[model samples]
Target chain A: MSLFHPTGPRVGSLLSGSIRQAAMTVARRDHGTPSESDGAPASTVVEARTSGPSAAPSLGPSFRSSEVIRVEHLAVSYRRSDGAEVRAVEDVSFSVREGEFVTLIGPSGCGKTSLLRVMGGLLRPAAGQVYVNDVLVKGPMPDAIAYVFQDFALFPWRTARANVEIALQLKRVPRGERRRRALDALDMVGLAEVADRFPRELSGGMQQRLAVARALVSNCGILLLDEPFGALDEQTRLVLGVQLSQLLESAGRTIVFVTHSLQEAVFLSDRILVLSHQPCRIKKTVEVPLPRPRGPDQVKSPAGQRIEAELFQLLYRESLV
Target chain B: MRIRPASLAEAYVEVGPVRRAPWWSPAGGRARLRGALRGRRLRVFLLRWATVLALIGVYEAITRLFFAGSLFLPPASEIFTRGMGVFVEEGVPEALQTTAVEYGIAFAVATLIGLSCGAALGAIPGARGVGRDLLQVLMALPQIAIYPIIILFFGIGPGAKIVFGVTHGVFPIMLSTMSGVGEVEETLPRAIRAMGGGWVAVTWRAVLPSALPSVLTGLRVGAKTCLLGVLLAELLSSVNGTGALVMMYSANGRIPQLYALTLGICVGAFAVNTLMTVVERRLTRWRG
Candidate 1:
């Protein structure tokens, strides 16, 4: 079993009073988006109340809409220093519909990152075709999509707001509009106060959120995040995961994420693509039916546990091979 | 359970509404000003200058009370005055001007050549690896040893000094450019490219800007090395400039004049280093 289990003994004691209270609030409180369909005990959480927040219930069944991104028999390889081609990923096929968060999870060095990069048009597939918005992607499509790098690859020299403005600058957006929109995105991510602060001045989670703000400022339809919170600790990841679900709640953009954490895969993903060892291939696809707002409590619920277990086993077995 | 301590705060500090104190309010304005003025940076600045002045006082005392003649160890006050004397001294002013001109011309040439070469070397991998090895070898060789060959080829005019300065200064700037290019994390350029930003946009916007601080750093080192190189050439071959003046004074046992001339060169180098630092800090103000 992994550490930081919500129901486990250590989680409550390990977390300080405030975080425990926040976690308690998150696990117990429901924004009451969908009706009371949960099979879990009501005593565990306060009675669900119908609350109308700014973000109306996810706009349409964009999940049921046409495939926004698709890959068929996609293969990626790299030439060794000795000049021999070593395959990283092959024969992986998947489709993500509009406004759905699809996560790719696998064993270490399983080419999950390479597969994501290929879809982003960063790395060319050695064989087969990858499509974004039904167009075969040959290079980066920054206008249509934005990639959130694993390391929170923010420019060291730009302020949090300026970093968000980079893509808009490339788009040649008006200066007034760019500054206003950049601040709006930072405000959306709860980083409005740090809009003028440099990246180094902020904490790790703030930097990660700033990166997300940078991606969001352009308002691209598709966001391809390669473990945007990979460098962060488990607590930060949990909070960012919840924040991402809320972001999706409001924005309703198509997301393709690559991560190593099974809990993370199950927590935020509409569907999880589990890949095998090198020469990576999709072994299974698990669809999460836990509804729109999947919080820390939802992740610990029966539905979330079953899917997390399955994902863990798939990755664990692949790693053994 | 080997759980580490909570190295991270799980939540951010609660933020409150911003309230700006009225600028015209005497008590509020004075409080903020005092808080800012008595800050850590100001204290450090004062301490730094205090230490410098104290060291100067100790040196002054030692030279006046313990030292022998003016040729052996001139007083600090005399050195300062004599160092400034090169300005009004008849032929000394011309020689100083010549040295200043030579240094400026050499530095400019070095920067132009170094930047172009570094960008070219960094942009291509086949060249970067080979050039890196070549640079390592060149950096290992003593610059003094190359003086004979350079003077032979270009002669004892501005040509030899310029070439020498370029040779000394170019490597650091080039290496800095190469590393700066390296520092532009691949993700940024890729992100720009993916965002409809073309190659030219990527190079100009992301590549050059990100590498600037590092390139400036290389320039700082290059400037000092160029100064050293030109002066070295002036000393060995040229019959004019500060380097030649120092040699002429030393040969005639004009120790105070030699010391003054050397001090002038030091001050000039310090100015270059300080100016470059200010530029570097301005360009990289966002960095920690």
Candidate 2:
């Protein structure tokens, strides 16, 4: 029985069976390699499809790279306006391989954005540690990472090109290179024509692309996107999602995307981490086995539908809780 | 809901659709011009003016007909006819020049000092509370009652008027600037910081633009207050200007000249307000 098929037993049982299979597959892959059994290879091990009662689709070969990010026992809390302490995220652990695309998906207020913020060093976790390429994330390391906010947080006063140029200026990139790189990033996002236009002059979707341009032009190895396409209309969202997938494919940078939309996650991610409600815990990690260079045709494939249905089921169950 | 075409037709007749003509048509252009002229807002403004004119006419009639023997009440026409001549009198003109100089100097000094101090206080939380309380105290003080002391110190020249004006104008600007900078949204500063902006960048890019509209508002308030301060000083001890001219006409029982000078002061205030409004509009165009 396929774990993703709707005809399976309750989603929880399917999820448990898949997790067990993934664990066994990871154990076998680790046994083959001479690497130490410190759960490090498990972070990069791609789960294999097996003949079992809860067989999941096989993930492709792993992209070999050292861990770019390692988050361990992370917990975050905030004081409410009424002075009550509310824990947003608690004891969540995950790691991402270099050049990999990992996504975090859950219902609203599940603290996916909070976890991304912790990784980006924008918000300090109450407990546990986040390591970026072996160094602890004490503050925003502009050289190592860049963040794209959901609201297309471009400076309203600046033109699109200027917005992209800002990060380069901060890094003290040479004047000519700054201009070239900024233009190049805008070109990637198909916003070269609107480079001189202010944020107000462009549509909401265009503004988000400009934000992506800004992040990409920084040339940081790790990119954190916090629901970047959440504000767009449905049609615009789909178009931009494909464009983003292509952009990331070319850039080959590690991406950790946070979104509430399951379809978006299934469409863009190599691995989707479903999170439970607040004091959020990672409930399941599903590997997307569909081959990339993904397009509209790939989106309509049987494999895509299966993945989408599985993600939706996980999200629906999470919402009920 | 009744689908009654006849009733709908009757309703349309009672409140006809506004017929819009093509923009390039001669009659259309004329109609647009007339519509612009006869808009509801324009009608309201005209009605207000008509009321004022009628009141003035009644006052003129009462003075000219009912108070024939009285020298204190003069007809409005007589005041209008002689007002410009009195304004051009050598003593009056010199006094007016002195007041203008005093107003300019005081307004400029107060604006600079207030803006700098307020910006510093507002930007630094430690200074904001104490600075605001001190400013409140200054604002609460009776500025006019201190004229005698100002006269004793500055000795009734343009210096005294400038001092008085500064005292009156500085508080509003300071208060406004403090509130303006304080009211800047937190998100803007956070966004700047996320972009790797330091304190200087955040202040220049985010805080300053957000606070500008309020700063302009402060400037307008300061201008009006400075004008009031200048008038107060002149009324108390000035040797020349519109205030001095009013005093002189009143003492000599020149009712018509006094009335005319008062009307001139009203016009001057209106002109100042209109100029400030135009400047404010131009400078704050980026707000939209």
Candidate 3:
């Protein structure tokens, strides 16, 4: 089973092996022509195998055509106070296709964030490598990847518009273009009215929206969201999730979203990757059979309920261990 | 699933926008009257003025009644009447000019040194530990004890006085600036880096602005200390300046004129402090 070819028939064969060796074989085989496996007909095979009895429908030919990001046998660990190494994420390998929304879900402290950080080049992996557009990610590629942190790490001093403009300013975009694009991004998040207000002056939901605006203003092809709506209340989370779905659907950008909410995972993702408890590894991969541009209606649908129920069972089982 | 209120109107009656109460209404008139007299700034201002006027009245009453003929305690009225004599006195205006020049130069130099040294200590991890300890020790030392050393190095001219003022003023500014820079959150720098901001941009956009409020506070405290240092140095060794004039008036037993000169200096210090406070508040408006 090759991890790089996500929709291949060989997915169920490999488990708990040395991924480094497997990665080399897979990388060498699929490195040059990554999208060869994602042909139009292969998506139905994906739906039948992963979605099972509640299979909805695929996005058809034009969607998820090529590979934009590849992670090969990635592992993340950090040193403890006594100098012992504690592995957080182990043997995690996945690929995000162009314009696909993939969610990583697991119990708390499962190192889902570490995997995302490794992909963003904010945290270095102990093993394996991440590639964006076939270029190895050694450090933050601000031009190619924009990250929305869980904590809404906005500059307290700058106004909302200025905060969004910072992304373009870093790339040395001219002043006029920067202003136009920053306002446009703010408008997309329904925050154009409060564009001149400071982050602290905004409510929690608005602040997260401001963070999304900042990420969007960069015009990057890929976005890495780390529990962006984690701190909000239930209603706000649903609203934001719906807004995010609409926004991403239009933009056709690749996204790797990390979250803890089962309903959120089922509602917003094209595919959900469930991870095991500690020393995180892929526990199960569920293809969302729900339709795109998701809203509250999707979560109430029968397919959404089945996916959510499966995810809850997987997480509940892991918690007992 | 539980049923929600089909309409909020089912739980409570929905009302249209209420009309405003007329000014003649009893409750409205009473509320307006209370509002006119109830405000934080107004209360504070009235209290402050009352305290000053009461103290002046007490001084006037005590000196005129209890110390009627004493040379040491002149009446408040006599001092006010003789205050104009301070400017008219020979060499008095020249002495004031000298003090102003020394204070101005010392303040400018201290600000320059304090900002640069503070920024260096704040920005560099290597310097922070040792530099902070050294600053702490210097700040705690009684600056007057070092006056003789300053005189020995710079001589008993305006140079010595200015140097003394700098020593007294520099510590507060430096310490505040250092702490301001140090207290900037680690997330801010990381956020800037993630945006592709280099070292200069991070310092300019994140570090400096975050530290500004603390730096302004230090400046306010430094202004008062510098003024004190200049006056103390003048009183200790100089032959001319406002400090020397105080010495001469007291020596000649001109008590009312001496009181008048002291009052003038106090007024000037008060004005400078008030001005600094306003500036600090103006710049850190975002804190609100």
Candidate 4:
């Protein structure tokens, strides 16, 4: 049996009840009666702490493990101009183990971006659940999740460091700490030298790295990268892919990466999840058996070649469909 | 084909003899200077000036020779002489000062009103269509046609001039401001939101900066319109300013003075346009 029932009324009741109870407590606090003045409410506070909001839905002991994210039965769809609903992702399910690098490889328009958006809580799934540390995500949980977009969406007006600082700012981190963390993140991406330069001044690869730095600086447990290096040339992509692997390994963050390139998937992932075309479903999940601290030569190794070939065939078949 | 030494020499002489000078030598310096003069941007600038000068030359020649001593079509030289006197005249400074004040006030008021209305309308969802249509209708109604109505209300003073100027100036500014805010890139807003910005944050950071270049364009157009409005008011009813001076000279049959005042107004308009253009360029340099 599932530890946290997927469609449990208990979880729903817990969410609503906690919100109501929080509101009531806020009202009582506003009215200025100290908890000690009301002994009954003081006992209620102890109950609220032990059996209240945090206890409502059992996020499962799996969440307590190093693993930071768990997703189940996620579906995303958009209504077309003609009023037809185009389901982008349907019944997609996956989980990221703590400090593991996993990538979703699929053809273009196969809902890779939609999947990442769902992971980041930017889009609410039609009929599924995404749990970050046992809590169901309803909106952007910026404190726990950061996203690196495919297009290297850095603010043109801000310097590379400022772009990273912006994410920290949203989290309400103190100024001195924000800058120091931002600088450290930039240093990890090897963009510390160009910290003062604006996005326009950087090359495509550099800009992508700066975006990675921005995501890293947020100190989120889970990072969702939607084809972060898709726009770069091959040589730059390969170099940056290795750099990213090193950075994430050092940070010990769970990453759910999406990419169109099979080689990139094989190069960076602990496991490669192959997704089908529109209304994308998980076709297969192939565990990448390649050794860690993977380099370019490993990608050329016999095992890497076999994995790439398998992913290619799966992607090619999906495309034909 | 082989050529005899004499024939080669003759050909060289005919074609302009090739100088045995280094690339940066005096001979090469002439060629470089010529090339610089013929560069595309320099050529275009020179062509504009040349056309304006040619038109003035044609007007000066026609008025001097064909007008047959008629004061109405005074020659350019006569206008220049009278223009110098008009500049030195006792009340001319005060008239210029009054026109400057009126133009400045009109431009400032029009810009503020235009930007506020334009931004509010442009940024609102589904309202741009109605706003644009209304603006188009307003723009179609000429400010000149309402001069009598405005004079009735403000009674032919600086107030009327300012009101007239503002009426003329506001539309272009509004339209430009709307266009500027409308053209903010689609990805910019999405990017900001993805980074966890709320509506106000997106507007202040992404939308405003992206719309700045367009705003500058509107301000330039508004500046020109303000100049036009001020002139129209002065010509129609004002007691002072370059426009009133022109009207006084015309009524008095002082054709030379009238032409000089007209020239002065044109120069003033040109100067204001040039200043605004410079400001626009400086402000929008980052857009490229």
Best by DockQ: 1
Tens-place lDDT digits, model 3, residues A1-321: 212222222212211122243334334433432322322332332223233313434443453346678888999999988999999999988777766788999999999998988888888999999999888999889988999998988888788999999889989999998888788777666566667777766777778888998987786878999999988887667656755764554444678999999988887888889999889999988888664434556677887788889999999999999
Of the true interface contacts, what fraction does each candidate have? 0.46, 0.08, 0.26, 0.12
lDDT for each residue of candidate 2 in B32-148, tens digit (9 for 90 to 100): 778769798678888999999999999888987898768887787788886557777667777777777788899998999889988888888778889889989888888788889
- Which stretch of 10 consecutive residues in model 3 chain B shows the poorest summed lDDT? B1-10
lDDT of 3 by residue, B1-288 (tens): 111111233112112123345558998777656765797756877899999999999999999899999889998889989755887888988898899899989999999999999988988877888888999999888888989988999988899899988988899999889889988888777778777788998899889999999999999999999999999998998888899889888899988889999998998899989999999998886675
Interface RMSD of 4: 26.8
Which lDDT value does model 4 have at A276? 93
Position B179, candidate 3: lDDT? 87
Candidate 2 local distance difference test against the native: 0.75
Residue A261 of model 4 has an lDDT of: 87
- Compared with the true structure, the alpha-carbon lDDT of candidate 1 equals 0.75
- What is the DockQ of the complex in model 1? 0.30
lDDT of 2 by residue, A1-321 (tens): 100212323322322333344454335433432321332243233322112102322332342136789899999999998999999998998888765689999889888888998898878899999999889998778878888988867777677898899888877788997888788677656566667766766677677878998887777778999999999888667656765764565455789999988778877877888998988999888887665545555556898889889988988987887
Order of candidate numbers by TM-score, starting with the best: 1, 3, 4, 2
lDDT of 1 by residue, A1-321 (tens): 011222324334323223334334334323321221232322222111111111223324563246788788999999989999999998988777666678898887889889988988888999988888889999888867888988887877788898889879999999998888787677667677667777877778788888888887776778999988899987777666766765554455678999999888887877788888988999988777665445667688897899888888887888888
Off by over 4 Å in 1: A1-65, B1-72, B77-86
Q: Which sections of candidate 3 miss by over 4 Å?
A: A1-65, A79-85, B1-43, B126-130
Show where candidate 2 strays beyond 4 Å: A1-65, A169-183, B1-81, B120-160, B239-242, B253-275
**What DockQ does every candidate get?**
0.30, 0.07, 0.19, 0.07
Model 2 chain B weakest 10-residue run by lDDT: B1-10
Residue B207 error for model 1, in Å?
Answer: 2.5
Lowest lDDT block of 10, candidate 2 chain A:
A1-10
